[model samples]
Target: MTTSTLILPGSPEWLRYFSASKVAALPIKLDERGEYTRGVSRWESPFSLFHRMAGHLEPEDPKDEFTVGHAAELMLAALYRELHPGWRLSPGEVQYVRTDLGVPAMATLDRRASRGSSRRVVEFKTARDANEFGVDGTDEIPADYFIQQTWQMGVTGYTRHPAHLMLGMSFFARRLFEVAFDAEVFAFLLEAARKFNAMLAEGIEPELDDTKPTYETIRELHPDIDGTAVYIEAADAQALLDSEADLDAAKSFAMGRKSWALKQMGNAQYLYVRDPGGDHKKDVKVADRRKNSHGSVSFYVNKKADLAAITGGIS
Candidate 1:
């Protein structure tokens, strides 16, 4: 889903991080220590950028990019309105999006202690569509996404579920596919978060533990879970079919549970952070370029794990 590195230019992680925060109307809560935790401080998501260009209604001979983009956005906004009644969004927030993840992280989630309150996180994604662009169709999120979503849950202590995965999607020709939250995926994420947090406390950052059958155990124990994390599927796939609607019908292509595509606006628009040869940027890293870029909020890396490896920033 949003976690995939298949995005146009930036790392898949960077793209998803920024896109979700930008489109979301609500503000992301600061980390436990009050450090800002949102991803990407600039640029609209590819889908969001195009969607805005399409506007409320379609224009004759609309840019295919804008039409498609607008349709996707309109549908999602409408879906959010339907699913989260109290949830709010601010359209202009995209103007100042940032992804500092707070030098080092202000705080990390604690796995052992019981967490209180409902926590939520969102991620965004767009693919080549069913129209065919190599081998791009996927109904499932990459394993990394599960970990990333879970990390948010772990970090924020939302719902006491350990983690939650909110998947959003917009395929070129196919309607958007949205899956609000996958409990199973969250469980895996929670475990990962739990382990990662534990490692952080111990001055370590847990890597994908090949020693354990990571996902298998999670799947087996999923039904036994009862956490409060709330996942709102932003799309109503059935709406498009039953209403005989157009692309304006919002559905989430990102989340697997829902499917929607804006009716083709002739003028769909698409954009990239680097509009025609812009400067390049890199993810927050663990100092020495010789080492892998680990322990960053974008990757839910542990604070103390790579403390020595880090030349700058603090958690």
Candidate 2:
């Protein structure tokens, strides 16, 4: 019997398998449940996979209806089903699939959709605006989300998986993008999972990355600092000191540039960029200076600024 047939989805046996969504972000020496299990087996869900991969000591807390993003997901899924004809959307029951390296994995899709013989794995997401989802002008999705969907497609055995994104808090704006399963990416992920499991078996910790989750994990690992002194290699001590000096120099340089920009924008509330097209001239606001009631001034650049359109003269 195959691994999938051996362990039924959602069963106690299934809980021992690694989740496809968490495979990419699963930290070294950490169990599937975000707890240290050493040589024991554990399980993980898609909801907290991103945090787990980042070496966070704790998984993400459950979200409720009060969370805007979670609420938008529910609204978008329902509205999409109502608007589209012949499309049946149902909760994706847990699915089990094994990686090429023989790593048992499972996934629970956001929505399993079907139209006659055509089937798809649907994922719903919400952002403050279209820009966040790259629906405004670009074609980029977050790397973590892309990996999660790819893993889901592998488990569901679907060729097409589409993302349903809702922009803002309302259901007025929405966009859909079709994604295809990538065998090469899946193979790479499988190898990564194999390596992680190997490290877990040996109880080896992975090196830390420059992420907040990793930093927080380091802090949690040493909560109470005793007055005992530990000796470090001379080379390691020099490297740490050099890194601190570089960081301080970079900060000073950034402050100098900020001061120069503020001096150039003296007395001007807004900085405008003029783009000339044929006989027409279009003016776009690139940056603005605002003064609050507390008498403190702040400067900000327009995050939605069109860089291509503003490549002309600035005034």
Candidate 3:
């Protein structure tokens, strides 16, 4: 979608859901970044810095969405190949699955039904810890995660043998999986969707009690989205996980540092910030210091000079 026709062009509306991004950036769990970023444009205090730091406490990669989601999707495609070996993998599946929602994370897919001729509805476990699955082959799937994929199946109108699979297994050691259908899951999806739609109507995104809402919360609320927590057990699963883990770890480490990018917006030539390791860096924005040198994890935009290019160049 183009930026010109957006309902909430939050990239420029920095004053509504305002906060400071001058210290460390803390990504809000909800879709409030638009509102928050707009607000951050005018603040002038340490609190602004603090809020910015907190909002960007996690990593924000400079890579585009396709670059990021494509890697995960590619993994899923490979998993489908392993499970059904040459069983005509549908590009339509990608189109349907790429289906995301305006609410973000609550995406839906227009998939084929899992009824008579359908084998099962498979899901992938890109990230599974060591002790998640059972050893003796008793099929141990995390109920919450199972609910999510099952919910999607329910949304796609599948009633027969619905299963959630993992692409990676034998703990994080391996990375692939398969599954059979369950009726209990489909019923759960219907109820969850009913409630989730209501929350969206109220402009309320589901968030945890202690910490702010993360994207996980957004996906879980979808009634048609039962969760999946399967083990990763493919032959190449561990290798795949190792390769991706390094990338993910770097992103995770970068989050707190990126929050400090907000301080660059200030007119203060000498900006102070709390570095990711929790150390204060008085010389962070000094002259001749290249950006990546300090290892930033946030999107750096000058409120005065760079706000236009920050988001969609809204206002």
Candidate with the greatest lDDT versus the true structure? 2
What value does the lDDT take at residue 269 in candidate 2? 92
lDDT of 2: 0.59
Q: TM-score for each prediction? A: 0.25, 0.64, 0.36
Candidate 3 — which residues are off by over 4 angstroms? 1-69, 72-83, 95-116, 135-139, 169-179, 202-208, 212-315
Greater lDDT among 2 and 3 belongs to: 2
In model 3, which range of ten residues has the least summed lDDT? 17-26
What C-alpha lDDT do the candidate models reach, one value each?
0.32, 0.59, 0.37
Evaluated at residue 232, the lDDT of candidate 2 is 98
Candidate 3, residues 75-136: lDDT per residue as tens digits? 56565566555344444332121123321212122122233366345554444233345432
Error of 1 at 169 (Å): 5.2
- How much is the lDDT of residue 82 in candidate 3? 62
lDDT per residue for candidate 1 within 1-315, as digits (tens), equals 111122322333322232222222111224456742321223222222222222311222546764564455544555544555654443311211223432111112111122233434433334432221122233244433434444444333343332322223533232222224455644543333233334334554112222123334334335555767865454754664565554334343333221111122122222112212232332222211112357432111122233233324345
Query: What's model 3's TM-score?
Result: 0.36
What is the C-alpha local distance difference test score of candidate 1? 0.32
